[model samples]
Every structure is written in structure tokens, then in C-alpha cells.
Target chain A: MFKIAVEMLMHDKTKFLGLLIGVAFTAFLVTFAMGYFAGFMTRGFALVSENSSAKVWVMDPAVSSAEATINMSDSSLDSVRGVAGVEYATPLYLGDVTARYANGHFQSFQTIGVDDATLSGSPQPANLLHIPNSVIIDSGGTEGKLQTPLSKKDVWSYDGSHLQAPTRELRYGDVMLINSKRVVVAGVSHTIPRFPPRPLLYTTTSNFKRLIAGEKRYITFIMVRPVKNITPKELAKRISQKTHLKAITSDDFKKETVMWFMINSEDVGDMVNMVVLAMLVGFGVTGVMLYMFTYENLKQYAVLKAMGASAKQLGDMIFTQVFISAVVGSGIGIGIASLLAQIISSPTFPFRMMWFAPLIGFFGVIIVSMTAAFISLRPIKNMEPAIVFKL
Target chain B: MSKIIASCKDIIKTFNSGEAEVKALQGITLDVYENELLMLVGPSGCGKTTFVSVLSGLLSFNSGVCKLMGENISAMNDDELTTFRGKNIGFVFQAFNLLPSLSAIENVALPLTVASRKRAEILTLASEMLEAVGLSGKEDVKPSGLSGGEQQKVAIARALVHNPKFIICDEPTSSLDHKSGEIVMELLQKIIKEKGASMIVVTHDNRIYKYADRIVHMEDGKIIKVAS
Candidate 1:
């Protein structure tokens, strides 16, 4: 009977292919959407990830996320270091700045400043200190909007109007202007791309103050390392109590950042909508196709019933058909999604196939297949075996 | 006296159409004996098909005492009836009712499979039955590849594969030509004689009347005459 079920489903090549393709498409769409969402959330809290050595973060009470920060006064860093459980503490500065290329092409960038002595959160501390007036730019920024024109001929005209053409990739020794001061690109740092993708520049706290000029309260956060005996959560609690400021472990900070984006960003909402729509489409197409397949072969089922096949045998046959479709379809779909993810993902377009992406797709296919089987079973369950004589 | 293989007494089946009640079988009472070929001849819309369905336990009646192989089928639960039917009854249909996806041997093996026989034994028995039905070299051939006569032979092979005590055939020759119908009836008569099994064949075709040991005529929902 199980053999009969397989033969019946496979014998109709056209319908079998249609059902497989439908399930595959659903799995692919759901997996890709979920991977994209996971990648986006990961990058949303990239700052917390980069400073993984720091166990606790101290910030102004109102600052909820790393991307949107309120600057703390200079006294905050000293105050955090004074806490009993804090072993080491360093200041971090974050601000947005516009840089003008040598050819006068301007682009906005997110500037990050680590403590001058420790360079606590700098992606490339050695490179920052290797050159004078230097900053390390993220690799993604170098490939995208921050690419510098090769020469005046690349962008300039006599009338001061520029025609943009072939630009050179930003690399070592490239010069850009921040606040009317010259800053050299000392090195390229490969960092996780941020949401809303702004170019990144990393420098020392002293260099940042010198370049931007006249910002009295510049420290955005104070990164702290807890003592060997103290956990980060315990240290954070002590700091928050002692300083009257917001203090959280790095993991908690990352979570807070992701929550902020989930609440505030439309992109997350849009991705969730896409996932739901994919599931619905998967359910609709697979359900209709399975129901139609069963309906067309109803005479065969009636024949089996009249031939003394029990209701349980008939149910097993239907389930066998659905199980094959789901397993094979999900396999093909996840395979395609993995290939597509590899081909399309880049620093600029973030996509990571987290372990759960395939899990989501597989369970999603199962749910769709089971629902289809249930719908197709209704007609078979109620069909009278005597109808075989009539047909 | 030949053993009574099946008996039906005061069987009544009805259907609901909109607000009206349609009587499909009205008080059908009959006995089928071993080693006999019983044919139910009737016009269209008569109760022959419905009567056989009740006797085979493929259907339920509004009221009746239907027994097959000495068990009261109307009193049995669905599971018990299904098990009883699988073990005791065989069927051949007007349309042949062969599953198009399976080959000749698989179709013949369906009864044994339903009986939960071992796979090795099932294949050997199904192969032997197909060969006995004159489909020896065509065991792997699907029904679509076979002619009407050959398909009917396969259906007959399937009907006897499990050695059921009784066989129910619904218009088994209606879809075949004159020569094919003669061949089918001859084959059925020969097989029933060899196996010593009783059979109830429902048909409107008069061409196969010579093959029956007993002929029962029905009209409008009742048996009007029985000739033996």
C-alpha cells in the first residue's frame, strides 16, 4: 500500500513536479527572508560585538542603543573606573561626520573614537597608531559611497561642475577632509556592515577631538572590564547603582540595540511581512495542488476501500505522499537558498545563513504539507466505497 | 447440501435526496451457496448492485440481517467488518477498477497485502494467480498497456489471489466485447469450479446467462424471480 502511494504520486510527473516546485519556492523564500533578518539584527548591534572584550558598558541614562547615543561628560569615564568591581575602563566616542574627498566628492560617515591609550574598541588599533592624522575605514565603506576619484579629471570641470566617472578604491595613503582638516586612511578594516549602511571611520579619542574640535562632552560610552571574581552583570549592577547612570552587560546591550531596531525600524516590519506572505503562499499552492491530486485519484481510493483496505491504511498512504513531498521539497529549497545566499551576499548586502534558517524552512514545509494532507483527507474519509461500483 | 456461503434477510437501504427519501434496496433476502455461480440480472436503477454491496459488507443498511461466511456483518464494527471482508470476500468491477499506477502483479497482490501477508509470499502468490489467469509474461505490464480482455483477466486474477470464500463481481463483462465477454465468463466458471468458491455476479447483459448455475431477476428494488 505504501508502494502504491509512492507510485501513484510519482506516476503523474507533471503534478509531482508542480508540488515539489511549490514547496521548494516557499522554503527558499522563507529561508532567505529569515537569513536576511538574522543578518540585519546581527549588524544592528555590531558595535557591541566589536568590543567583545568589554564586559560592561556605561552610558547616559537615556541612551538605549549603540547607534543612537547621548554623550556622557568627561567625568563619566573616571567615575566608572572608580567603581569597586571595574578592573579597567575606557571612553568611546561616536558621532556622524561628512568627509570631502580630494576631488571634492563628499560623503557622510559614522565616526568612532576609542580611548587613545588602550584603543579599546578600535577595529585596527595598530594601524591607527602607525600613521599620523590616521583613521581606519571599514572595507564596506571603501567599496561603496566612500570611493575616491582618481584625479581631478575624474570629477572636475572648468566651470566647477563635476561629471562623476571611474573612481579608485580607497586604500592606504588616501586623504579626505573632516571638519576642514586633513585625515589619511591608514588601513582598511573588515567590519560587519551596519543597518542603514553608513561609511565608518575609526580613530583615537584625542584625534577625534582634534579633528572635530570644540565638543566638550565627547564620551559616548565607557567600556569596562570586570574583575576576575565579578560577573559582568554584577559589575553592571554596581556601576548603575554607584554612578546613577545606565549600565548593562555587553550581551544585554546588544539585545537592547536589536529591540530598539525592531521597534523603530520599518525594515524589520517589512521582512516579517515577507516571511508571513511566503508561508501563506506556500500553504495555498501546496494545499490546492495536493487536494486536486487526491480529488482526481478519488476513484482509485474508492476502489481500494471496496477492496477491503482499512481506513488507517488509506490514511497512511496519504501521509506517505505528503511526507515525501515535504522532505524532498524542503531539501531542494534549502539547497537553492544556500547557493543563492552565497552568490548574492556581500559586505554591502548582508545575508547570513544562521543554523536556524534551514530549521525554519524544514518545519515550515512540514506544516504546509501536513495542512495539505489534512485537507485532502477529508474527501477520502467520507467517500463511500460503493461509489466504486457506480463509477 | 452445499454449504451456505452467504445469506441476506430483510435488508433495507435508503438515501436522502433534498427532502425526499429514496429506497435503494427494499427487503432483499437471498442465499448464496458454495460452488455455485449466481447471477443477478436486472434493469438499470434496480437494487442488484445495492443488494450485493450490503451482502459484501461494503455498505450498511437501514435494517437487515446480512451474514457472510457465517458472521453477521451488520452487527460488526467497521474494523471487524473490514478485516472480515478482506479475509473472506473478493471483488471484480465493471470498469476493471485496476489502479493505473501499479502493474498487473501488484494489482493482483492487493488483496493479500490488505490481509497483511508476507511480501515474499505475496509476490509468489500474485505471480502464480496472474499466470493462471493467462497473463503469465505480462506481470509487469500496467493496465493501460493491456487490452480490455487482458485487463479483465487481470481483474479476475486479483479477485481470486487471496483465495476468498466468496467473490462479488459487479458487471464484470459490461465493458468487454462479445468474444471477450465469452472468454471472461468461461474463465470465471472454470476458476470457481476449481476453487469450489461461491460467486455473486451483478449484470444487465444477457449474453453471459448460460454460464450461471442460478439466475436471479430484479426490478425496481426487489427480486421478482429466481431460476436455477
Candidate 2:
């Protein structure tokens, strides 16, 4: 009987292909939406996620997340370090700075200032990030080439009107002006981009203070490490209670960042809306296609009924057809989505295909297919075997 | 004399369209005996199809006693009727209504498959039945690829493959030419006689009248005459 159902579907090749395409598109939309949402969530907390060495973050009492925080007084770092269950604390400088390339192209960049001595909170290797007047640019942030004087030994000279160096290293030796002060690119740091889409750069806290003259005595956050036996949550509690400042564990800070993004960012809300709309469109296409296919085969169902097939048998046949289509369609859809994910492999694009996303699409297709089967099998249930004789 | 395999006592069926009511079968009373080929002949819109439908338990009559193999069909619920019909009655349609997706053997094996029979057993029996119907080389051919005569032969094989005690064929030869119709009628008679099974065939093709043991004439939803 299941063979009969499969054979019937195969006999109508045009309709069968139409059904597969419908299901495949539905799967593609569903999986793509899920993957996009996942990528957005990861991007929303990139700052907290990349600073993995910090167990707790101390900031102004009014701050909600790492991205939307007021710069706390530099004295707060000493207060945080003095609290029990806190091993050490370092000032973290975070702000935006505009950089003018030697080529006259200017771009806005998000800058993170790590402790000069400890190199804590830096997104790159300590040796590369701790160098004076040196900065690390995010790989995905720059638009085009950043030309600089060719230099290898970090020495500079002038030849008439041109800047001269002993070596020619294009991206590594790039020189740019930050706040009208010359800065050299030490290396490129491959890191995830945060929201607002600004290029990210990392430098020493001393250099950050030097670049921004008026913002000398303030810091955005104090990165703290808990004692050997104490957890981040316990240390955060102690710090918050002692210093009267907001102290969030790294994990909690990640959640806070994502929550702040969802509540504050219009782009996050728009991505969620897009996901819902994709689901609606997928469900609609699958439902209508399955219903129309079953309706077209109603006469054959009547013939089967007239041949002494019970309603259960007929119903089972319809279910078998829908189930096969759903499974096959999901497979093709996921395959296509994965291929797309691979092709659009640019780090700048927020597209990440999680392993569980395809499972969500699979279950969604099953539900839609089952709904279609139930609705389409209604005519078979009420069919009279005598109808075939009249036909 | 043969014992009666099916009997209809004053069976009545009516079709309602809004306030208009049409009687399709008006108190049809008939008896089909064992091992005999009874042909019900009538013009279009007569009660011939309706009577056979009721007798085969495919349709419900308003007020009548319809029995097959000594069991009252009206007493059985829809499910029971379906199982009873599947086990005891076989049907042939005017259009040679074989499933286009299936080959001839698979079409013939439908009844057994519906009964939850094993695939191996069903295929063997279906192949034998197709061979018995003189379609030995056409077992693997789909109905779409076969001619009208071959398709009709496949339908007949399907009807008899289950070894039902009674068979009802509605205009079984109407879609075939004279030579094909004669061949099909002869095949049906030979198979039914060999199995000692009774058959009631509804058709307007008078060329195959010689194949019937008794011919029943109907008009305006009522039986008019009987000839032997």
C-alpha cells in the first residue's frame, strides 16, 4: 500500500517535483532564518565573549552591558583590586576613535585599551599588542588597503618629501593618524565583529590615554580575576557589595549584552521579525502544495476505497506519501543551505549555520507535512466506494 | 438448480438535490445464483448500476433487505461492510479503472495487499491470475502502456485474483471493441465457471449477450423482463 502511494506520486512527475521544490524552499528559508538569528546573537556579545581571561567586570552602577556603559573613575580599579576574593584587577579602556589612513581615507574604529604591563583584556598576542604606538586592527573591519611607510625594524626616516623604511610590509607596516597622532599597525587580529559595524583596534592603555588627551583619568571597565578557590559569581558579589559598583560575572555579562541588544537594537528585532515571516511563508507554501497534490489524487483514492480499502488504509497511504516528501525535502533544503553558508564564507557577513538549526527545519517540515496530510485526507475519509461506479 | 448467492428484496435508493428527489433504484428485487453469469442490461440512467451497487454493499438502500452469501448487508456498519465486501465481493468498472502507476500484476494484487498479505505471496497469486487471464507477457506493463483490451483484461484479473464468492462488474465491456468484448466476456465466464463463483455483470453491450446464462432487462429504476 505504501508502494502504491510512492508509485502514484512518481507517476505524476511534474506535480511531485513541484512538491519537492516547495518543501525544499521552505526548508531553506527556515534554516537560513535560524542561522541568521544565531549569528546575530553571537555578534551581540562579541566583546564579552572575546575577553575570556576576565572572570568579572566592574563598572559604573548604572551600566547595563559592556557596550552601553559609562566610563568609571580610574580609582575604581584600586577599589576592585582591594576587595576580598579578587586576585587582581586591571583598567580596560574602550572608546571609538577616527583613524585617517596615509592614503587620506578616514574610518571610524572601536578601540580597546589593554593593561600595558599585563596585556590583560587584549584581543591579540601580548607582545604584538603591548608595543608602544602600535595597534592591532580587526581583520574584517578595514574596507581597503591601508598604505604605510615600508619598515621592518620599527624605525622611521624621511627621504625628502617621502617617508622611508628599510622593508615593505603592506598591511603590517601601515601607518595611520588617530586623533592627529601617528600610530603604526603591528598586526591584524582575527576577531569577531561587534554590533554597530565599526572596525575594531587594540592598543596599550598608556597609548589610549595619550591619543585621547581629555579622557586621561577615566576607564570604561575594570577586568577582575577571582581568587583560586572563589568563583566569578562570588567574587562579583563581593566586589559589588564592597565598592557600591556594578560587578557582573563574564557569563552573566554575556547574557546582559544579548538582552540589551534585543531590547535596544532595532536590527535584532528586525532579524526576529524576518525569521517569523520566513516561517509563515514556508508553512503557507508547504500546506497549499500538499493540499493541492492530494486533491489532484482524490479520484485515485476513491478507486482504492471502492476496491474495499478501509479508511485507515487509505489514510495511512496518504501519511506515507507526506512523510516521505517531508524527509526528502528537508534533506535537500539543508544541503542547499549548508552550501550557501560555505559559499558566503566572508567573516564580515553575519551568517552561521549551527548543527541544531537543520533539526529545527526538519521538525518544522514534519509538522507542516502532517497538517497537510490530515487536511488532504479528509476527502478520502468521507468518500463513498459507490462513487467509482458513477465515474 | 444452484443456491442463491445474493438476493435483493424491494431495495430502494433515492438521490436528493435541494427539494427535488430522484429515485435511482425503485424496489429492485432479484436473485443471483451460484456459478451462473447473470447479465443486467438497460439503457443509460436506469437502476441497473444502482441495484448492483446495493447488492455489492457499496451503496446503502433506503428500505430493503439486501444479502450476500446469506448475510444481511444493511445490518453491517461501514467498516464491517468494507471488510465483508473485501473478503467476499469483487468489482469491475466500465472504464477499466486500473491504477495507472502500477503494473498489471500489482493492480491484480491490490485486494491481497489490502488484506495485509505478504508481498511474496501476493505477487505469486497475482502473476498466476494475470496468466489465467491470458496476459502472461503483460504482467510487468503499466495500464497506460497497454491497449484498452489489455487494460480490461487486467481489471478482470484483479477482480478474480481474490477468489471472491461473488463478483459485480459495471459495464465491464462497454469500453472495448466487439472482438475485445467477446474475449473479455469469454475469459470472465471461463474463470467464474471454473471457480464455481457467481457473477452479476451490468452492461449495455448486446454483442456479448450469448455469454450470459440469464439476461435481466431494466427500465426507469425497475426490472422489466427476464430472458434465458
Candidate 3:
């Protein structure tokens, strides 16, 4: 019976293609839309990487996934340093720093100042972060970076004019512009580099203390890293009580970043709408095409019945055919969609797809195909074998 | 002679539509013996097809008891009747109505699939039956690709694959030319003898009548003559 169903689909490659392409496109749209949703939810807290090494992040007392970032007591830094198993503690002042672009325009930025330490500074700027002019930006961060180090004398110009920047074989002396406070490309790291406020810039704690025009000098976020004996959560709880501040470990901080992203904007809704539309298109086209297929095969069903085939057997045949279509179509569809998602991973859409979405899509298309098969079943389920005998 | 496999004892069938009524069969009595090849001939609108349908448990008469394999046809419910028909009876249609989507072998295996037994066994049996019907190596070919004679052979193969006790054929070769019709008739006669299954065929083609062991002639739903 399965062989027969396979033969039926194989005999009409054009019809199967139509069904497959239709289903594949629908799946692509749904998965790509999911990528956007995931991207949006994670972007809001790009600070997770920035504040990562800080095992204990001490935030404002009113801190939550849905609240505005506030100031922490400057005195809380020493108390955190004295905490048990406390190797390094820093009064990480995260603030909005506006960079005057070459075009004489200032863009708001997320800036942080960490006391020059080894094990407990931000991962994005652990080394040379204390330098006067050095920073890390996503390869695809501002201008969407290329992850390879390209060598051309013309590539490393005075200004940001290198199509393929000679990011290698250059020292802080050759790459740095200490006069204008610029951290030139001394090394090109091939990673999903972190950026703050959609773009990033790094400078020394001294420069940050002097450059931040505000007189209050109260830190926005306090950071600490656990030594050999201390756990991150315990440190955070101690900070929370001592400073009357909200404390989150790196893991909790990551969740907060994701949570803030999810509930803070309409981006999630857009992604949801996109998936809803894909499913809608999937179901709609599946209904029309599968219905036509059912209509085309109705006479064949009648003939089978006339030959002593039972109604249940006939139904199973129809279901088997549709089920095969669904499996093949959805499999090809998801495979193509995954390849596409990988090809388009950039600043425009940042997402790490879970196994769940594709798995769900696979099962989802099968159910949809079954429903589509059943949608066209009005004639088949109610097929009258007596008619063929009449003729 | 063996006992009757099917007996239509004074079967009566009527059709009533609102204010008008039509009687297709009245007071028809016949006993179909085991392994007998019976040809029922009648003009259009005669009760030849209806009688075969009732005997196959595919139809029910308005009055009278039609016993098939000793089970009263009228007394069985729809599911029970279907079961009895599927297990004990086979049919060959005039149109050679094989499912276009299924290959010749798959069509032949359909009855066993409907009975929901082991599928691989049914496929093997269906292949052998098709081979017996003179359609060797055409098992994987769909009905559309088959010749008229080949399609008819597939229908016959489907009928006999289930190993039924009785085969009900409605104009088995009505659509075929004289040569093709004779081939189909010969196959049916050969299977009836070998399988010990009785058959009642309805056809106007007398060129193939030599294959019938008994011929029952009718016109306007009334039996005019019976010859052996």
C-alpha cells in the first residue's frame, strides 16, 4: 500500500513539486521569522557579554527585566571586594557615551569602565581595555565586519576607509591614534564580537572617569567575579542585602537581557505575525492543492472500491499519499530554511535557531498535510463505491 | 453435485420513487452450485446485474431471502455484509475499473489490504494471481498503461487473489473486442475449475459462451430459458 502511494506521487512529479515548493516556502518564511524574533529578544541585552566575567552583577535596587537601569552606591564596590571567595570586585560604571562620528554627529553608546584586573573584567575588553584607545566591536557590528585579517597598505588608512583592513602584524604603536584616542585594528578576532548600544568603543578607566561629564559619578552597574571558593549567586545575594541593590549572576543577567528584549518592544509581535502568516499560507495552499489532488484521485478511489477495496483501506491509501508528501515537502523545506538561516546570520538578523523550531515545523507540516489531506476528504471520506458499480 | 453456495429463493426487488414504483425482479429463484460457471444473459434494464449484486452481498432485495454461503443476505448488517462479501466473494466489473493510481499488482492486492492482514503476503499473492491471469511482469504497471486485455486480466486477478468461494462478474468482457473477450472468459473458466469457486457472469457476448458450463438467458428481468 505504501509502495502504491509512493508510485502515485512519483508518477506526477509536477504535482509533487508544486506541493513541495509551496510547503517549503511556507516553512522558510516561518523559520526566518523566528530568527528575527530570537534576534530581537537577545539584542536588548547585548550587555550580557559586556558584563559577563562579572559573576555577580549588582544593579539598582528596583532592577527587573522591565525596569530602567539605575545608579548603585559607589561604596558597594569595597564591600563586594571583601565578600568571601572574592578574587576581584569592580565598580563597573556602565553609562551612555555619545561618540562624535566623523560626520560631526554624535551617536548614543553603551560604555563601561572596569578597574584594570585579570580574571574579572569584561570579556570584550579583558586585555588592553585599560589602554587609552582600544575597543571591541562585532565584526558585523557598525559596518558589518569581515572576520578575516586582510593585508593591504591601503587597507589600514588613517581613517576607517579599509575595504580589507590589514588587521594583522600591527602593534598598538602602529595601529593606535593616541592623539585622537582611537584604537586602530591591531588584531582581527573572528567571533561574534560584542557591541554596546548597537556599536561599541573602549577606553581606560582613567579616561572614562575623566570623560564622563556627570559630576555624580555613581556607577550604573556594579560587577564582581568569584575567586576559588565563592559561588556567583551567594555573592550577588550578599551584594543585594548590603547595598540594598538588585543582584543578578551572569546567568540571571543573561536571562534578564533576554527577558527585557522579549517584553520591551513590538519586535516579538512582528516575528509572531510572520510565523502566523507562514502557517496561514502553508495551510491555505496545502488545502487548495491537496483538495485538487483529492478531486483528481476520487475516481481512482471509486474504482478501488469497485474492486472490493474497503473504505478504511481507501482512506489509508489517501492518508499515506498525503503523509509522504508532507514528510518529503517539510523535510526539504526545513533543510533549505536552515541553510538559509546560516547564510544570513548578520546584524540585520541575529539568531541561534533551536532544534525545537525545525522539529516542530516538521511535525507541524505533517499534521498540516494530514489536515490538508483530510480537507480534501469531503469527497473521498464520503466516496460512494456504488456509483462505479452503477456504470 | 455439491450444495448450493448461493440460493436466490423467490427473490423480489422493487423501486419506489415518491408516487411511482418499478418492479425490476419478481419471483426469481435460482441455486448456484459449487464450481459451476454460470452466464446470465439479459437485455438492458433486466435484473441480471441486481441478482448478482444480491448474491455477492453487495445489494439487498426488497423481499425474499438470498442465502450466500448459508448466511441470509438480508439479515446481515452493513458491516457484517461487507465482511462476508470481502472474505467469501470476489467481483469482476464490465468497465475493467482498476484504480489508475495503483499498479496492476497493487490493485490485485487490494482485497487483502482491505481485510487488513499481513501486507507482504497479500502483495506476493497478488503478484502470483496477476501472473496467472496472463499478465506476467506487468505487476508494477498502472492500469492506464495497460492494454484493454491486460486491464481485464488485472480485474480478474483482483477477483481471484482473495481465494473467494464465489466470483460475481458483471459483463467481465463487455468493453473488450472479440479476441480479448475470449481470453478473459477462458481465464475465468480456468480459475473456476482450479480454485473450485463458482462464478455467475453477465454478458451479451455469446462468442465466449462456449466457456460457460451453464447459460441462463433472461429478458426484461424474467428468465426465458436455461440451458446446459
Q: DockQ for candidate 2, please give it.
A: 0.59
- Using Cα atoms, each model's DockQ against the true complex is 0.63, 0.59, 0.28
* Best-fitting candidate, scored by DockQ: 1
Candidate 2 fnat reads 0.66
Kindly provide the TM-score of model 3 when superposed on the true structure, using C-alpha atoms.
0.73
Candidate 1 overall lDDT versus native: 0.87
- Cα displacement (angstroms), candidate 3, residue A179, comes to 20
Best by lDDT: 1
lDDT of 3 by residue, B60-125 (tens): 678888898898878997557667777888888888777776788888888887777697898789
Cα TM-score of candidate 2: 0.84
lDDT of each: 0.87, 0.85, 0.69
Per-residue CA lDDT of model 2 for A1-391, tens digit only, reads: 9899899887888888889999999998999888878776777778777778888988888888777867887888888889988888988888888886653446778888888898887765668865569998874334443344443333333233233333332467678889889888888877886665667778998898877779745688888888899999999999999999999898898888878888988988887888998899999999999989888788788777767788899889889999988989888998999899899856688888978789989999999999999998887777667777876
Return the candidate ranking by TM-score, descending: 1, 2, 3
Q: Which regions in candidate 2 have their CA more than 4 angstroms from the true location?
A: A55-65, A71-76, A79-89, A96-109, A123-190, A206-219, A224-252, B16-22, B61-63
> Interface RMSD in Å per candidate, to 1 decimal?
1.1, 1.1, 2.8
Classified by CAPRI criteria, candidate 1 counts as medium
